[model samples]
Target: MRVGAHVSISSSKATSDSVTPPHENIANAVFRQKEVGGNCGQIFTHSPQVWKHQEITDEDAATFREETEAELDGPWVIHSSYLVNLCTPKDGLREKSIDSMQKEVDAAARLGVEYVNVHLGAHTGAGVEQGLENAASALDELDVPDGVTVLVESDAGSGTKLGGDFEHLATVIEKADLDIDVCLDTAHAFAAGYDLSTAEGVDDTVAAFDDEIGLEHLKCVHLNDSKHECGTNKDEHAHIGEGYIGEDGMNAFVNHPDLAEVPLVLETPNEAEKGFEWDIARVKELREN
Candidate 1:
């Protein structure tokens, strides 16, 4: 399985030298992935809290693509800004979300990344049907490059947030005119009432996902353990094998044949002396030959 962490692209040096440009210094993500023993991973184009994206110079883009090709077994993904609410009912927020997403997809193309992952966000009083329509229409606005595909991530189902149910995911894909895919976050799925705490639970959840959304559309897995119990709707991520989706569940999920070819990205907490390096090592241990 291809697995890695969501790493920072910020550079250690303030300014660029001979090889790389300042704005597009994401080449650092590649080095960081290798240092942590990851073969593939994810990165933010800018501070996800704010709606801004750093520009990627062509020179820097070339270096990033070349380095990634040479060093990693990659299909890197760029996670969109947190403020983007594709399901928003308000016009101002909806426009902002669309603009932000457009930039994210453009950046993904510039960086040679294959996927751009984002949440469907909250419906914010719009009915589920309208919210899904809003999301699908908003996605249709992007001029996605030929090789890039947008992925709607499963949410924790808190408040009015969409993407909590497998039906929501299937709905958006069906409604959207674009060729999109799904990124299943284990923690979020468990929190959203899909039991992933045992081998049987994992099996059931996989079957459910395959049924609701085709297995072919499962492009990636946000491989995380939940801090909360199944159906809690909480979004906290725990280290692999240590959270509510304990060792038994995690072991079963990783080695499951249906998921063997899907890439796993770690969004687990980096605190408590168990960072991505430790998490990546743990995943390697979990996978059986």
Candidate 2:
């Protein structure tokens, strides 16, 4: 099973014997993943809150690629900025979202990362159909690099956010001119009313996904446990097997035959005592051969 966590790429001096000195480059993401016993993972090229383009030097890009290939069984994904609202009705916000996404895809190409993940943000007054159209149009504007594919992540369905339903994802893929894929966030899907807290629920959700959005489009899974109940539309992630989607649900999810090939990148909280390392190990333990 390919599994990992979202790791930071910031520079820091050596803190302890167990920790390596963080270099002032993106390659530190790879090192951080290795330290946490992850084989594949996700990274933010820049701060996710702000709309900042990644200024990766050629040297840093080269180093990142070399280190990733040599040290990890990787299909690293670059998570786009939080402010990128492809579903926005306003022109200025839509244009900025497109620009931010383009930079993210280019950065993914430079870093040899295969996927660039983004959310189809809140529609903000536009109806569901118009929101889907806006999202597809925004995605069509990007000149995506070769080997770098854009993945629209499933949302928690709060307010007017798109991608909450499998239908929204399928609609965007049908409407978009650009070739794209989907990343199913477990917590988000559960929150969006697709129950995944038991083996039967997981099976039902997988079948629904296959029926609405083809299984072929699922390239990755944002493996997480939800803090809220099913259909709550909340997005807080909890430790594996310790949330509403308990041990039974997570076991079913990780070991599902249909999802066997998809990479699992965890965005679980980094709290004391149980962080990415512990989460990754727990996932491995849950996987049945």
Candidate 3:
């Protein structure tokens, strides 16, 4: 039942050499999150280094743990970089994707992060089925750290991206041969033609997910409202209750008994203006009403 946003410590206020390491700032950010009334938080482990190029020393890992456990009160999650594209047909990109995923798994294990969430990428002209298999193949090459789990994020289905629908995600999970899970984005699901705006549509969508990927495998929920209309295949994110998915759709998903205990993260716009305190309160309001 923890809730928070992707807070950046290293990137927030710094220069090339002047910037603090990710672990330092993230630990402090966790304290800020708690002050802002968040029960848990998410942070990135390192800078934009390519998977193979990035390096973390043992001292840095020890520092990160000490800072986080001292500053934060709950679980912490890590988000993989956007640069990774497992579905790319090209050999170089596929190799990089697999390497990056493995690096993330290692980093998460070092930092004690329980889950690493990643997106299914666009397939270009490779077609959905091929793209899914490519994604699964890349996953097969990466080792799942003992304490960490990998979760594929549902995309908006824009362009040639895979994982916009339950069937595509199910295929990737089934073919991956890895202990993978899912992170459902309400806006993405609605935009990808899941029809979560209505009661029946929401029920149908949930049922499909249960049958296709197994609801038990759902590890996290990204609570976002869509700026585009349902089935638009767009990925614009709006604030809660202010966009297409609106209050009704989000309410049902957040309050569903099956997901009541899972962590919910907000990736909405205008948090600096509206504040996560208010945003999370709004989500709490919807859950109550």
Best prediction by lDDT: 2
Q: Please give the clash total of every predicted structure, in order.
A: 0, 0, 0
What tens-digit string does per-residue lDDT give for candidate 2 at 117-156? 9999988999999999999999999999999999999999
Residue pair clashes in candidate 2: none
- Please give, for residues 164-262, the per-residue lDDT of candidate 3 as tens digits: 988888898889889899988888888898887666677888898999899988888887888999899998888888888877777777777777887
Off-target runs (Cα >4 Å) in candidate 3 are 14-23, 47-60, 66-74
RMSD (Cα, Å) for all candidates, in order, is 3.3, 1.3, 3.6
Would you estimate the TM-scores of all the predictions? 0.95, 0.97, 0.88
> In candidate 2, which residue ranges exceed 4 Å CA deviation?
13-18
Q: CA lDDT, every prediction?
A: 0.91, 0.92, 0.77
Q: List the residue pairs that clash in candidate 1.
A: none
Error of 3 at 167 (Å): 1.0
- Candidate 1 Cα outliers beyond 4 Å, as residue runs: 13-24
Deviation from native of the Cα of residue 58 in model 2, angstroms:
0.4
Better of 1 and 3 by lDDT: 1
